[model samples]
Target: MTIQEIVDKILAYHPDIGDRRTCDVIVGADPNRECTGILISIAPTVPIIRKAIEIGANFIFVHEPTFFSGYDDECEWLEGNDVYEEKLALLVDNGITVYRDHDHIHAHRPDGIFHYMMKHLGWLEYLKPQARGWEVVLPPTRLGDLIAHVKERMGLEHIRYIGDPDAIVS
Candidate 1:
């Protein structure tokens, strides 16, 4: 299927976002091009783009902006910038289409990002619906241990925290 078709299919699963403008858009290459493979990521950094090329992926589905801006479509300020130009050139030359699924994914029922994050952290069962948002109630544990758990679950080398490591938390 074409990149645009795949993007449309994803949007179809989201709740009606009304007529308000959204950040979800094609930020690079041609959406009409047939997709050979897809690379799903949090952001389309230069390294990620290179990895996509190496994997022979013609389409990249990202949850964040491709350009260094809140709205990826606004590129007037990025003109003449070396980094922006290089990234754009990489996408264009490699024929890699980059699509951001930001707003729509957040608008999805149960919230697409948070739901998956909770599931990945094994905290979905601890989720409690609050008036304004959801909360996760974990068993009491030391802050250091919780941080280590998060790092292991997310496969991160390091993480930053601003509290006493020995402090108990839930």
Candidate 2:
């Protein structure tokens, strides 16, 4: 399928849900170009782009921006910079098309990122979906223990918590 078709399908599947606008856009290549394969990534770094090319993938659906900024605007100061040129060249040379999926993914039903994380970390059973994130009432556990549980479950090496350690969450 063509990159345009993929973009259309993706937008249809996860259309702008609320007041937020989607950042999804074909950042590189012609939308009509036929796709060899697709790559999904949180961020399309130089290495990721290279790997995609090596694997014959021409389309990337990224969660973040291809350019340095959040809005994916080209940095003016970096126009003549080597890093920017190399990164841009890599995508252009390989005929890769990048589409950012940030806004829609976050606005998705049950919140895509949160739901995925909770499901993967075995915390789905405890998730009580709120407006933005899950809300849960624990069984009178200490704050430190609760934090430790989350850290261990999420495979986090470090975490920063707000509020008192001895304070009850629920």
Candidate 3:
């Protein structure tokens, strides 16, 4: 199906009781809306947008705004206080329409992003308490080894740790 059609169907499935703005982050199609590929993601960050382009996904169906609003998606008096105006400009220049699916993905069976991500991590079951992220049954691992392993696995440039980096977690 086309992008517009998908967006409409997404809005029609808002599960929240008082959820009014289900279209908060619904972006758009390509310039001609004839994109060869589609990419669904949690947000339209500059990195993710660039990745979409690199992966040949001309259409980006994001769950969040391309530009950060500083506040929690409310572009009120804090409208122009975003630090991502440049990213917005890039989207326009690249003919990318970014929409938020914050509710759309979450409204999926269980967590959309979480479920999507879980597949890669090989997690069959998860203890997903609301507010808290996840508790997967992982093999025993050392903190340092796990941290280093993760850093290498994701190819991250830098990682920040808050807890005692040396202290081990069982």
Q: Which numbered prediction scores highest in TM-score against the true structure?
A: 1
What lDDT tens digits, residue by residue, belong to model 2 across residues 44-113? 9988998899899999888888877777654676788788788878888879988888788777777888
Q: List ranges where model 3 is wrong by over 4 Å.
A: 9-19, 27-32, 39-42, 46-58, 70-94, 125-133, 137-140, 162-167
lDDT of 1 by residue, 1-170 (tens): 89999988988888998999988889778889899999999999999999999999999999989988888888999899999999999999999999998988788657888888889998887877651235678889999999999999999999989999999999
Better TM-score candidate (1, 3) = 1
**Per-candidate local distance difference test:** 0.89, 0.79, 0.60
Q: Pick the candidate with the highest lDDT.
A: 1
lDDT of 2 at 26: 68
The lowest-lDDT stretch of 10 consecutive residues in candidate 1 is 127-136
TM-score of model number 2: 0.77
How many steric overlaps does candidate 1 have? 0
The clash count for each model shown is 0, 0, 7
Q: Write the per-residue lDDT of candidate 3 for residues 1-170, one digit (tens) a residue.
A: 65566656766775553745544654433444645566777666778878776877666776666654522345545446555556655665666655566755676665677676666544545444553345565555667766776577566767887676665654
**Candidates sorted by TM-score, best first:** 1, 2, 3
Instruction: Please report, as a residue range, the 10-residue window in candidate 2 with the lowest summed lDDT.
Output: 129-138
**Structural similarity to truth (TM-score) of each candidate:** 0.93, 0.77, 0.59
